[model samples]
Target: MNKKAIVTAGLAAALSIGAISTAQAASKEKCYGIAKAGQNDCANISGTHSCAGQSKTDNALDDWKAVKAGTCEEMGGYSKAQAKELLKKQKEMKG
Candidate 1:
């Protein structure tokens, strides 16, 4: 390919990778507890369990932890610390 074309392709590839990473991070889930894995609502977990949560599959730890910390508070009754601990226990139990 021409030099210009090669440069354009490289930039495109970089952008594509960035987009994929961002999307993957966003998909990392958070959970309320061990027994409740698939549900996404933070409120129910906090209301019933006193915890809010998030999850990341086996591969998404950083994103999962961070998102859960920020968003798990919506669970109606949990403090951020409780939500984080609940999520940590759930992850450990899953292992």
Candidate 2:
């Protein structure tokens, strides 16, 4: 292919990748209180674990799993703000 065509193709590929990334990010949200035991997406806020599928407890406020945005509540998952509040309440109860 000609130099101009090659450059255009490269730019198009880069743009397509960027668009896909943005769309995925926009659609996913960090949801807490929905991950099953040993099924969390990543680290927990309490520093107990740092990998997916390592949680010992289900529906932990410190554990978060990614779910489709705008569907967390419907799925019985808590938003970040709500999770924080729940954590605070738990701490108060413990104290």
Clash totals, every prediction = 7, 0
- Taken over the whole model, the C-alpha lDDT of each candidate is 0.48, 0.91
- Kindly provide the TM-score of model 1 when superposed on the true structure, using C-alpha atoms: 0.36
Best by lDDT: 2
Which stretches in model 2 have alpha-carbon errors above 4 Å?
2-8
RMSD of 1: 10.8
lDDT of 2 by residue, 56-86 (tens): 9889988999988899999988988888899
lDDT score of model 2? Answer: 0.91
